[model samples]
Target chain A: MAGDKMLFVIVIGCGRLGANLASGMSAAGHSVVAVDSRQSAFDALDSRFSGYKIEGDATEFAVLQQAKTVSADLVVAVTDNDNVNLMAAQIAATVFKVPRVVARIEDPRKEDIYRALGIETICPATLAGRAFMASLESTPPKGAHNA
Target chain B: MNVLIVGGGKVVYFLCRAFISKGYSLTIVNRDSAECAWLARRLKAVIVHGDGTDLQILEECGAERCDAILAVTGHDQDNLAICQQARIRFNVQRTLAMVNDPDNEEVFRKLGVSAAFSTTRIITSLIEQRTGFEDIINLVPLEEGKVNLTEVVLRDISPVAGRALSDIALPENSLIAIVTRNGSPIIPRGGTVLAAGDRLVVITLPENMGRVIKLLTGGR
Candidate 1:
């Protein structure tokens, strides 16, 4: 998202997706704070990632409080653990009243309940499953069938 | 009543026993295979080996029509997910959760769990109550404060301190469910005697709280 206004963003879980988003957003000039349980997870962030890094369990309220979630303009939960992501996202949305909160939920069945709670969810399984289904359409590009 | 309990641990066995004795049909959902096997051998409830947070597992355990769902998992997040999914997807009216973090009790309530209990808060309250007051040690609210549970210690000053439960006329809608005598809990029966130094766990309505406390502690 590009706008003239800069936003304070908190990314929970410094996994591959979390680190990439934190680095990208930081490079884009937004204030970013990346949180992870393991300090080594920060190694994945790009050196150009000028965002602040805090190592702790993002699912914990204390960690989010230390990350200044109360003033966060946006919070993203991309942890590998579905429950952790749900907890972090819900706390951001309900407890801290963050404006925008999104979570990566691997279980597609849980997406509806997450949305019902006023939080957005990205389910990798559903997204990837759709992509696989689209690939089976068997429509080749121009001249690709000849190859 | 049919109740679905998630998580297979020591609490599961004891809860199973308690509910079974009460004549309620039960089902247990657990993630650990070995624990599931052990629970299957030890308990009389249907065991489903899967993550309780998953909607499919709850559906497999017949959560849709169960009278209540209890999430006693060790993790607060998992417990919240289980209860939330049970309520949202299955439309289970009564859902209780064991909150691992004492602070998340309010959070769980706000998130739509029917009731949330925290052992840490209870134990902390007991310890603090021992140091804080002579009687009426701790108070906990449930069902959005529609009901209240209080821990009252019977002292020499108490009016009903030396009487049996059958002899005392307790306030309407209030009951002394458990009596903790010298650190052990005894479910108060008709013949159970209440003595000084016994801790009473009383469940009552919000309106009668003060009167119940006064009656128990003779503090009016």
Candidate 2:
């Protein structure tokens, strides 16, 4: 949507969120590198996904180096493990000095910590809770019927 | 002195006891609630039930005012984050992290952690000293293992056994500090003659250690 400007992005983990982001970003004409500890996880990426795939633990600094995080414009750490995501995000922010770093944290309590460290985080539980609450508060469209 | 320790396990339990005995005020941050309860009851310290890598939890534990922070979590990444946060955000004077992978030690050091200890490297070195090479025993490692104090035992068939210390070609920067033969110790001099069964206390760079060992043990 922001013209044809291509951005270098590194996505840690190959879970649903990571795979989707990598594929979606690549489709949008961005250079993307997706990393996962298990090679099998890369199977989730669709054939249209044009990003590079790296099989290694993101927690290890060498793996991040292999991903070429130093030149990355954005880093997304979406690993299922909170500590792994946090560490990856911190390395991207503090060590590599990536312009933008985001981590998916499952624990809402960790939001303050991420904020303190200046890391952007998305928590699915909080988002889902808010969405459910909004659904309860909003009335359905006149044409819509209860299933 | 106030100390903040992150993680709970056998190591943390022992450290808690040691710090308590040393009269240091202690606070522990751990994610496991059960472990937190156990630590709270067993140790004379405050236990916070949350991840140590979390800034809120760390702040609640008074990380900013702590004299030292020890991040000894079983997970290397968690330990790294905890130590980094302690140093960068809290500005703790001293931060120590336990690295499960020895290769991560340098990375941690470069990231500004005051100290990084790898149990794997320590155990590997200990085992190597006990069973490796047969002639060279590493006494101590200095300068992050760049230099070492080594003990080389001279064998009967060693090429330098009967040679004067000055005559034997040694690796650069290597110096034989003392030679103990039979039951007496002698400070090595240029004219000192090396003998079989003599134990040579040498200081050398780690890269040249093998060469020194081979020279003293007849290349065995």
Candidate 3:
């Protein structure tokens, strides 16, 4: 892994998304570290990972210290709760002074909160509509006769 | 370019695998080390066992030089924070984030992210297509209402199943791009004929969906 110089990424959650992301990034030749509240979250990871793995509470300060985010190229928060993720971003910005930090916001209502916090956000609802529309475009209606 | 991933979801897995195939530099951040070991060994990407939302951990992971950052955790908040850190704090050139709520796409775009996607959206679209349309199995978007890619299966009820390409009048702005028989994809030509159980990939304008599907399958 050291042979190639690329971005270093850390994922906060070890749940479904966290595990999949870690495995995928590793496959892509990026250095990755995955963390989760529970050990079971790691079960989904592939056997031939391309990066290191750690199990711990991503919201805690001690866990962050162990992972060494101070010099990381990028940091990602994917925990289940929104508040914890926001706090994590605050810490990343205020304490560690990491150059980059990103957060996911599932609730469209809390978009303003995330934006006010100076963090980036992804809304799931809008994405759903877009995908639905896209699929509609490709899906021909039933019972239509075309040759 | 160096890429960073900040989630451990299914989409993240797919994204990571795609990057690996492209030979891009990659790094992953997660809370679990043991579970991620398999991926660690496969792509040889460095893994840090920690929270991505933490500033110190992100710094340690080297966010400054990353060319792109993607956040795809189960929680939308976490993905947002990772993208924020990568773009606002680290100054990463490109940032892609995942939204669990499809409604939040505008918010992501407004934040100046390079791109954003939601797994729920993709899955729902697939489900909707399968349930709402009997003849069409798959649909992919193209330009805004101008054209799209569709997958259709020919059944016994299809009127055009036994017809040659020249015999049927295709809907305006609609074209059959491919045909599959015996599970093998075949490029469609003028003389090609449609048969039962064959799958066709077609491109058509949005307004032509009703006409195209009706003419091809006879509207079962």
Candidate 4:
């Protein structure tokens, strides 16, 4: 951990996905700050996670400022709401000028908008569909005669 | 002028009617296909079915050629993104957004949205005005409520009622622009003497508004 450059990361939202990402990043020796509107969302993070937790709406500019997003090297917006994630990610990328910004959007159709803004997006629905299709393609169909 | 309106709701319907009546061309982009069809059937404007926050949808709606973009989505974040995209990407001259949260107004302004209106705050202020805070009635707030134009009514018991404009100490950066007595408007001057029932139109910073009100209303 001494030789590795610790990246300062701000993760907006503390849902299951957000919490897991925060904890993982923290475990990887990165400085992480997790933000959520509800204080209870922090419970999703494991006790071993030592990253900072901020209870506030990530869509707020002031809250982001309080989270020290201006100095953040990477910002991830994983809020359950697509609009909230998009707004937080855009603020990180465009307003705060963060070098790397990513948002989690449920609707895969919104990928174009995120792309146009030059923000990366992860859609669980699309990911799951592709994963299921890949698994199905790898396995032989049932009741098929041996070739 | 051509205008691109994003989202669908009562506000969109009313805006569509108003803009169409005024002979302005409108193109509405709504994610709800049913609402888009409803708007298409009722209004003469073109309807595009897609998420308004999507830049591709907005481009399909011809946002670049539009004179203005109105983002009135229920979600404040969506409205912010729509307005920002329209302004920065499409170069729309005017971008108006409906702010669901009053606290986000300054942030929207800082992000370069042409204007953001908080309906909740406006209604609250209207109710406050009706509650009759007699000393001063705020006429308008400009620059995110930093500067205000207010009407101050001078009562008979006011300390400055009989004082000349020069003698009465006004708050810093505050100016008495005009005076109305018995429905007659009078231009204010240094020698002008304030009287009971005189309505004064004052322009001042918001922080100094209270001091100006206290001085004019006899410290009430």
Candidate 5:
């Protein structure tokens, strides 16, 4: 949103959520490199969507390098496993020097640690509760946060 | 309009740029200073290093004075917390949240949020587009569906592909607004040729759906 050029993003994990975000971001005019160990992940991508794709474990440094994670301005770790996602975020932040890291932690309790570490984390359940409550106050859905 | 975003993740980046281009001020909040610097340097958005859910951070960032507040952190909980504080605690008038789950949209509306967008819902709609229905990929509901804006993808068999917009026998209450093709978006003109794979965004009433679909897909 900030640059004249598209933001360079690398998404770890090629599952349903990951592929959707990758394709959606690409549609939103961001440059993206999406990776996953399974070919099925790549298959779900829109045929017309143009971007980079690599097949390998996101946790492996070699795999990340191959996907050119170092050059990415932002890295999104949306893998199913919280530990792997945390590790991916660490790699993006500490190892690759990626400017920003956003990881999904399924467990809401882990958020405190994620925040303390300076990594942005999203906990689905708590966020949903706030949104549901906010909707009760307005006609159209309005955005509301808990903090 | 100036907007202060409560998070510095991908959605914030996308929305900030979009609103900024449409002439809106943008500020980003994140816990990481380096991330703040990087995001700020690129988007020219003001970056505040603090927790988005913190009342102090929102006030210090002057979020109350802004036109709109968008909380789109990876954590739905954080986004919800920030939006609520901005509303009830700080009294910020306009607020929006990203409802990570599609099933949560109705729930968000009940909470009084201005707008709630679910990535899951939008993605599913996109995936449903491949079904070969060229007339209207997704519809933007308006006034309880009294009038709606819809997108139509042009296919090879479309009867209106080569015809002028004015010549097409579109049902009353329907208007073609824009056409997006091959990644290039264009404002519609009367004589523009609709090519295969072109995505057309049209505004019309629900009653016109069948006619629109038939014309765009050359009815089976």
Candidate 6:
């Protein structure tokens, strides 16, 4: 879908979401640079992933500098820790002037504040919670009601 | 005054004691259950057991009414998040955060943290000041680095070493605060003579720090 423009992408946190996005974007011919504190997290990237990996804390400016975040058109922060995602995303948005930045915040309540700071936020908790609630309404799970 | 402190450790314990002495109300939040119990038993402040960065935990701590919030977590990101949440969500008047990385001090301040101090910055500044210009005894960046408290040691190489304070042309907005000679502090005056080994504590703007040092040390 992002094929219209060849963009440079920086994905912080090489976890499941980060790996998948980096792999897919790289496969789509976008230049992808993935960063993670743990070197092992790079293993999650798809075999076709041609992006570069930088093992470092995304919250640090030096690491982002090493990742050449200044040239990034899009930055995605999906670390397990919401705080890390918030800090890293803010740096990419404000400091590096990335065109688009997204952060994964598990807490739905924090989405507004994150957005107010000019960073786009995705709440996995709220998304899953809504889907699970909808399924419960349709299936009428008796065991869940009793438990 | 009411203060809410996020994250618990020796810093929290000492902070609580200091605030208690000043008769300020205190609330401390920490994630570890054992640390919370320990802090609760020792300090007079209320100890909250939960992630300090969690907005719910901060709200439960009555952050909305807290006069100040201090986030001294080991992680810089967590501290920044806690301070951001306190300022944005709770609208806390004053939010202070401990930055683990010295570089994050400016970044945190840019991101809306009221005050971001780094022990690493202080230590590194001390080392750097001591290393360079061996004549500079100590250097402290005050008022968020806008003002500098610089202590310079006068030597024979200084042009104004033996001159009276009034005779030397001190830069504008800069003053010699104190002069210490032979382990004795002397309030500087127009008649005060600069000795070769005298320690002069000069207060100056960061931009004028170099000029002040150059004027005193007779360096280019």
Q: Considering summed lDDT, which 10 consecutive residues are worst modelled in model 2 chain A? A: A138-147
* Candidate 1: TM-score, chain B only: 0.67
**Number of clashing pairs per prediction, in order:** 0, 1, 141, 0, 46, 0
Cα misplacement distance, residue A7 of candidate 5 (Å): 52
A1-147: candidate 4 lDDT, tens digit per residue: 246889999999888999999999899889999999999999999865799999998876789999999999999999998889878887788778999999999878778768877899899999999999999998887757565
Evaluate model 1: give its TM-score. Answer: 0.77
What class would a CAPRI assessor give candidate 2's docking?
acceptable
Would you list the rank order by TM-score, best first?
6, 1, 4, 2, 3, 5
Model 1 regions lying over 4 Å from their true place: A141-147, B131-137, B146-220
* lDDT (Cα, tens digit) per residue for candidate 1, span B1-220: 9999998679999999999999999999989999999999988889999989988888888999898999999998898889888888999999999886777777778777888888998788878776856566557786676888888888899998889889998889999989999889999899998999999989999898899889878985
Question: What would the per-residue lDDT of candidate 3 be over residues B1-220, giving only the tens digit for each residue?
Answer: 8998887745556778899888988888887776477567665677777888766677888999898887777766577667876776678888888776664454455545666676666797788655645668546555422467878888898988888998888867989999989979999787898999888888888788778888878873
List all candidate RMSDs to the true structure: 6.4, 6.6, 23.8, 6.1, 19.3, 4.2
**Off by more than 4 A, model 6:** A1-4, A129-147, B124-133
The ten-residue window of minimal lDDT in model 5 chain B covers B103-112
lDDT of 4 by residue, B1-220 (tens): 9999998888999988999999999998889999988988899999999989887888889989999999998888989878877877788989989887776766677667877888887787677556646657777677656788888888888888888999988878999999999989999899999999898889999788888888888674
- Model 1's interface RMSD: 1.3
lDDT of the candidates, in the order given: 0.88, 0.87, 0.74, 0.86, 0.75, 0.88
In the order shown, the candidates' DockQ scores are 0.45, 0.33, 0.05, 0.31, 0.02, 0.63
Those runs of model 5 whose alpha carbons end farther than 4 Å from true positions after fitting are A1-147, B14-23, B130-136, B142-147, B151-220
Model 3 off-target regions past 4 Å? A1-147, B9-22, B32-43, B54-64, B84-133, B139-147, B155-159, B166-173, B182-184, B205-211, B218-220
Per-residue CA lDDT of candidate 2, range A56-143, in tens? 9998888999999999999999999988898889778988899899999898877776887789999999999999999987977766
Error of 3 at B50 (Å): 4.1
Looking at candidate 3, what is the lDDT of residue A53? 69
The whole-model C-alpha lDDT of candidate 6 against the native structure comes to 0.88
